[model samples]
Target: MIEFALPDVGEGLTEAEVVAWHVVVGDVVEVNDVLVEIETAKSVVELPSPAAGTIATVHVDEGTTVDVGSALVTIDDGAGAGDVETEDEEPLVLVGRAPAAAEPRRVRLGASRPSDPPGPGPVIGHRTDAGPRVRTKPPVRLLAKRLGVDLHTVTPSSGDVVSRQDVEAAAALTSEPPVSAVADARETRTPIKGVRKATAAAMTRSAFTAPHVTEWLTVDVTRTMELVHRLRADRAWRDVRLTPLVFVARAFLLAVRRFPEINARWDDEAQEIVVPHFVNLGIATATPRGLLVPNIKDSHLLDLAGLAHAIDALVQSARAGTTPPAEMARGTITITNIGALGVDAGTPILNPGEAAILAFGAVRDMPWVVDGQIIIRKVTQLAMSFDHRLVDGELGSRVLTEVGRLLSDPGETFLHV
Candidate 1:
């Protein structure tokens, strides 16, 4: 029997919520066949079977979040599969691809003897004081144990069965006030997990650790709008979805090239300001799951058309919640387009480990003075937030000024390109 424990899918990932299971007990599976889908703090990923076999037992149910080394399922993969030797115990074989960082717990399977008859216990449906003997599954019981929550004290919101949510809610009340502490009866409690929880933790760390300074610049983007119009008219560019954001991204890349220091990180351990030649430009995207900041790799090397295409693809993938975990990692700088939601401006927070982030505000037609004459011009507000530990006021101002200049006049952008 091959015990399949949940593997660590990415760096620093300790646990994942089981979104679904494709194969149940008694189902046959081949190597590399999709076995289950689990959602981590980063993204939703499908895990494949490491060995071909018939699934003997499903240890975890859907919607249960478990640690990396927790047993997920057991498969009867014939008799030839090798086993890892252990001290004074029966030979056990775990999933081949399980991360070495987390060792699967040794599980003793079945009864010690055939006549033992499933151990001595009060059977299910046997009545107790608190109705039907506190109905719950193994996974829920395990969760309750981990959270220091007693099942008898939890009230089941969904029918009679105690769910994972119930366990989490009960735990929340004991620690830092969440479910039971609500003052209003109309309020609903949501367990923070997956993307929401990850975002909160990251933002909190970034806010407290880094000294953030945000600068704003409102610029006349008439020339940038003209460039967009011309691109729309061109037959070659018709296939591409051209927006002000594409221009903003292109301009930002140019500015980063001019001020590479803005595209760097502060390594406190090494006591160094590390600057990489390549730029992984992150685009902040809002999805059904949560806010995701998936980035494009080597964005500095891409031309305007390529950059546009890359941004489109990245945003689409992020919104659809299909973006790979790697795409969301290693971002040098970030851009959040609050304009898409019609917000005028915002002081955005820096993505953790990134030196800077740009928040592009909504474009509007406003009166401006040109050669001592008032005229209507296309204008937008640009706000940038940078880590003051790495970027001084002058450097941050220069980067923002360069970006504003490129947007004000597209010809300058072309020359820089």
Candidate 2:
């Protein structure tokens, strides 16, 4: 019999909630066949079988959370079905035989200590004879270190084990100093455990780790808006919702083709640069749960209508909180539509691992030079933030300029090249 242990799905995920099961006992499964769908802290991931076998038992049921090393399924190899032995019979060893047993090894504690040991110094109640010290666990230690709190100063009142609440209390005390103020306002605190927590850590890591450089440019998107208006009236786009975001996505793809370096990542461990040939276009979306950047696979290969369909599907999945984990991984580039939130323009941060991110601002009627005279035109601002280590100033400028050019002259794009 062979037992299938849950594989490590992604980076440092210890456990996952079994959202669904596709196979049951006595079911024959092939290698690479999806057996179950699990939800980790990052996203929903599908677990596939490793080998072809007949499943003997299902260890976990739907909606149950399982650890990483736990047995998920048992498969029967049908090799030793009739083998049986009595209790008096000795078990056979794979090797010839075991050697004679030897005495066990043991170490004596405090055997080499001096008579008069060093004092505990200024630490109070730190007894040397108190069997072992009661402190936080490994995870709690990491949390305290991240929060910049000295664990020695924390008062442990919750018995020997420190709970998450204790760590949170330590964090709160260390984050803010003593301040005296009159209570005149009511404030509510929301726990950051789910998507909000993950997003905050990612943004903080990206901001501090990468040297961010942002460039802003105002563009006349009159032609792009006109194209959107015309497409909305067409019969093909009748059922489809055409917005400025669609045009922005297409332009970003075109820019990526022109500037390939912008769609690359710096692999610090391997001492190599990874430039993806295909574009997994990530659309930064604001959902009811939190901010998510679920992406569309091979978005650069999709045409105008295909891109529209892909964007619509991704947006709907994100809003429903059913976006798959595989779709969110290996994103080559990203675009955030700050324009949808009625913002003119703002600097955006690069998605972790990606070299660049483009921010599309709100399009509004603004004065522009037309035939050497100022006229009201549909204008929008484009902000591009890139990692200086991977993308230089000239490459960033070229990518942003290409996106702006495509938007300014949508019809000319087809005629020029």
Candidate 3:
């Protein structure tokens, strides 16, 4: 019997919630056969079988969060199952939260060490006789990265090169993933004018194409608001503008470290989900031209003070109507502040290609329960919408919950800040 443990599907993902199982005991499987769909912090990934085997026993129940390297299944591969080496190292992640140094590992697809000789052509920088033979675009590379598939193993159906269809076919094992955005010219079209033409057309295409799922959570942030007030009086923050949004961004960044998948993109053309190591956090600003979401490049690398300064610069440039065109594009995830407009919360449409968008509602004085005492605490609502195709309910809920948790008790996030 081969003992299979859960692998870190996303960078720094220590555990995953088992979303669904495609197999049970007594079933024979082949290499790369999908065994189960697991929701990691960043996205829902289908774990493939490493060795063909007969039914044994599944160790964990559905919806249970299994830690990295814990045995998930015991498969009977018969007598022919060779001496497979078990991984003994911890998950090494370049981005997001750094994995614990002593965490053990298990058998997984594309398992290899940095010192190990690289796999063949089909992956990023796979070399051919001339140099590298993989003829796929960035989207295909992104898809392969997310699926954890080796490009060298994928055989393209058409042409003398690997294509998106080939990668999707190899990974999804189902029908092709739908193209992300599609715009149609219709008679009921709104005129090609200002924001309606610029924003509506693009957003309509995103809404119709991407499968969006939004989750809401109400959080008590009285302490968080108080912290902001305290920071404003500090000499370190004297030059920087400290606002609730800055704290919200900090909390969101802290959550991203735990749930990195929220900072991902759906490369529809590449036909796969893309998880970025760095966070290009988009701040949604209402402007005279239209609703513009200019993002902070490498926001994850910045500290709390740096984030506040970045937010100030981004908002200023946006409101001045001098925000560059490049800044408006390439947002991985977004944060929309509805409280500024006197709204609590609203379902937000995702910026095109981004996997998720988070909405921060108005924080106000509300009656709250604190240690069995009735008190007025600063409360707020957080609404999050993510692509259902990439993110499931479990993943979405955990990310939103983490954000709310940090806000409700931000003292825990000081270590990260």
Candidate 4:
């Protein structure tokens, strides 16, 4: 019998709330077949199976938040009723078929596991006195239990040893979560597990640890506002959602190129400054569940239109809770559009692992100095917070100044290629 344990989805996610199960016991499944859908900190991911066989048992009920290495399902490879090594002491084997049953349980969202507390737990799998006995690779281990695959009975075809394919093969033999489990309750709470929990802890640590320095500058972005209006009226941006945020993103991207040091991270471990050449632009979005900063992988490579589309897609996905785990990782820079909430400006917190964050304030018609004369112009404030460890006052000021310049005179500054 193969035992499938939940894998780390991404961003160090330890456990996830089983939003759904696509496979059940007695069902024939193939490798790469989606076994379950789990909700992590930032998104809902469909976990694929690892092995091909008959699902003997499902340890977790739908909506239950299982720990990372907790048994999700058992797969029987029809290897005959002989001596088999199973995680459980019962030592079950691949016998004939059996009738399926349902188990109901409640799960909490954003909650921690009992065994793995805030501090420490098993890194990959549980360790016993006998020895280390995890069946899958790091990635495969993450995929196994997530897809509800049993690893013990899974045959590793790869000459190199256990791979994600083996775990996926084991998952193909299962059916969806039981219908009775779905009807058990309309609402459930899953404690934050895995990446979600880790993100929370990191954010909390950063918030309290960093003595944040926020500086705000209100600029008369009449020209930028005019460009947005023109773009909206143009046929090129007809389908796209033309908003100030798009221009803000573009401006920040360009400004980062001018002041590259701001687009870096402080590595306290190595006592070094890590600067990135490319930009993974993160947009802070408020979802129904919580705050998520899903980013464009390579924002530097995208044009204004591409950036707008990417931002739109990311925001929509985040709000719907469908953003992928991969999209939320490796962000070098971040932006929070606080203006959407009608706020003028805010001292936004920096995302962990990144050195700086830009807060785009609300764009509104306000009296401003234009050519030394007071005039009603489209005005907005830009607030920036940077890590003092990597970004000194001069670099932060230069980056913020460049962004202000671009916004104030977008026509003069060329769009970042």
Candidate 5:
């Protein structure tokens, strides 16, 4: 029997919630067939069977969050079935809250060290005589034990004491109605997991760590709007998906190319600036799951039509929750289209590990001074927030200037392309 442990589907994701199972005990499955869907910090990923086999056991129930090496299922492929075994280590026990003598040790399959606990939540339960005791009521302690939760793993919602609600909340990381979640119909409680949880952590880290500087520019984009209409009418471009966003994406790419230094990251570890020649342009997309910034790889290499198609496909996949984890990695810079929701402008936070992010606001008809004459023109606002450590105000302003110039007169910008 092959014991299938939960795998790290995303980049170093320690745990994932078992969103769904595609097979059950005694069911036949083929190699590469999807066995389950597990949601990591970034996205939902489908795990495929490693070997053709009959499902022998589903160790983890749906809605449970399991560590990367925790046993998820067992499959028998005409091979001998045996008891699931653990690594060469002591039987796992909950630290701070020792299990009773009669209770059996729950062995996590791939646990290497006691610190590497194999269950779920903040810290998995493992045998250790160290660490401060987590304060909780006896009934809450019993509840944690029954649900296989470690008291040390649950972060107390209020102060130091862990309540029954905290225990239940830990159990329902990805599933179940949050116990005592409603004090009244006036309020609702949602378990922070999957995308939402990850977004909060990332945004917090970015907001506090990076010294951010924001710059704004307003430009008349009458020519860019005219170009969009012309492209829609053109036979060659009729089939291509085009929008103001596509133009904005193109303009951002051009600006980055002009100022390659802007497409760099501050490597604090190495104490150096790391710049890549290639640009993985990330588009901030709002999905049902959450905000996903799945990027287009080598966007600098694609032409206008190709970029439009890529942008459309990326947005559609993100909204449908089908974007792969790899597509969301290694983003150098980003663009958030707040205009899609009719917002004027926003100070977009820099995507973690990125140097800058641009916010594109709604394009509207506004009075503009052209040749010293006030007239109505298609205008829009652009705002960019950049890491002040890597991007000085002058460098950031120059990049924004180029982007605005390109968007204001895209026909001239394309002439060179």
Candidate 6:
């Protein structure tokens, strides 16, 4: 038997959470078959099987964090059951860095007895509270059994390894009859990990680490709305989905060109500013997993039609949870559409390592003064948060004002119709 261990993923990933298991025990798999799905801090990656064989056992449960060198699965490589050995002696085999990395090398440590399932956490031996069998002291296991709680379904309050506390919490939900508990009400506690946990840590650090100064501008976007309508009617843009946001994105790129400093990052270590010549415009998107900021590389170079296609592809991939890690990193600036949720505006948090973030509000009909005359116009609010260390009051204000100006007049800001 061969033991497949987690390999070094991109960006020096020391550990990853097993989001799911594609193959269970006793399933026949082939070389390069997708074995599991893992979520890193940056993105979700699918790991492929290294060798073709029958899956003997899975070392860790779904939603369990694992180190790189730890064994993940064991395979019957047709070498017979006697060929099994320990993982330390044999070198782990792995492919290139693109796909999720896992060091899959078979070492036959022999199978666990029928009564004992595979160990949790690392493959060697341990118990965890994730998806597989729940791990705990003998007394806690007895408590779970007595309370009729399926150890597999119970959530652990502490480490991946289950504790008596986790079992007690699980028992509390049923400590009282369900019908009676419904009247009393109860708190459903969800384990904070994976994407949700990572997002919280990142947002918290971003909010506190940077001195953020947010500015807002309400703009009359009547012309921009007209442009969106015209583009939708045009056959030339039939393939691309053109919304008010396409124009907003283009306008933001133009504004960045006018004020290049806004498309830069603050390098505190060097005590200098680092500016890039190209723009990698990040579009903040919400997914079932969490909020992801996947950017278009060299966005400034794309025309209107190209930009629309890029935005659509990026957003669709992000929503599908397939956005690659490369696309999420090194973003110069980001734009989040709070309008999609019927919100008028928001102060969006900046993506870590980026200079600024802009929030696009919903476009709506509102009372306006057009040349000293009362009129109803299409309008939206633009709110931006910038790192005060890199972008001062004057520069941040200029960027927001420019974006508003471009939306106010499409012909002046947008290129290629």
Taken over the whole model, the C-alpha lDDT of each candidate is 0.79, 0.71, 0.70, 0.72, 0.78, 0.77
- Could you tell me how far off, in angstroms, the CA of residue 66 lies in candidate 2 after the best superposition? 5.6
Q: TM-score for model 1?
A: 0.76
Expressed as tens digits, the lDDT of each residue in 312-345 for candidate 1 is 9999877655677788888999999999999989
Q: Going through the candidates in order, what is the number of backbone clashes in each?
A: 0, 0, 6, 54, 0, 6
Per residue, candidate 6 scores C-alpha lDDT tens digits across 1-417 of 778888766554678877656676655676777777777765777777777676776888765789887888987766666755444543333344333434433433334533235565444223233345445543344345435566787777777776767777877887543221223356634446556777898899899988899999999999988888887898987888897888899999989999999999878788888999999999999875678888999999998988999999999888766777778877889999999889998888888878899999998899999999999999899999999989999999999999999899887447553
* Comparison by lDDT, 1 against 6, better one: 1
TM-score of each: 0.76, 0.63, 0.54, 0.72, 0.77, 0.74
Kindly list the per-residue Cα lDDT of model 5 for residues 1-417, writing each as its tens digit.
567777656676899987656665545666666777777777767777665656656777667889988988776655444564432233222113322222122333333423223566332222243556577653355346546576788899999999878988889784543332433558666567778888899999999999999999998999999999888999988899889999999999999999999999989999999999999999999975689999999999998888988999999878766677888888889999999999999999999989999999999999999999999999999999999999999999999999999988777575244
Please report the candidate that would top TM-score against the real structure: 5
- What range of 10 consecutive residues in model 2 has the weakest lDDT sum? 85-94
**31-76 per-residue lDDT for model 4 (tens digits):** 5566666766667776665655555566776557777777777655
lDDT of 2 by residue, 1-417 (tens): 456666666566677766555665545565556666666666655566554555555778654668876777765444333432121133212123233322222213322223213564332112233234335543344345435555566677677676546767877865442221223348534445446667888899999988999999999999999999988898977887678998889888988888888999999999888999999999998875578888889988888778888899998877655676666777789999999999999989888988999999999999999999999999999999999999999999999999999999998352121
Choose 1 or 4, whichever is better by lDDT: 1
List RMSD in Å for every model shown.
9.5, 16.5, 19.3, 14.7, 13.5, 9.5
Alpha carbon lDDT at 121, candidate 4: 38
Candidate 5 residue 77 Cα shift, in angstroms, is 1.3
lDDT of 1 at 326: 80
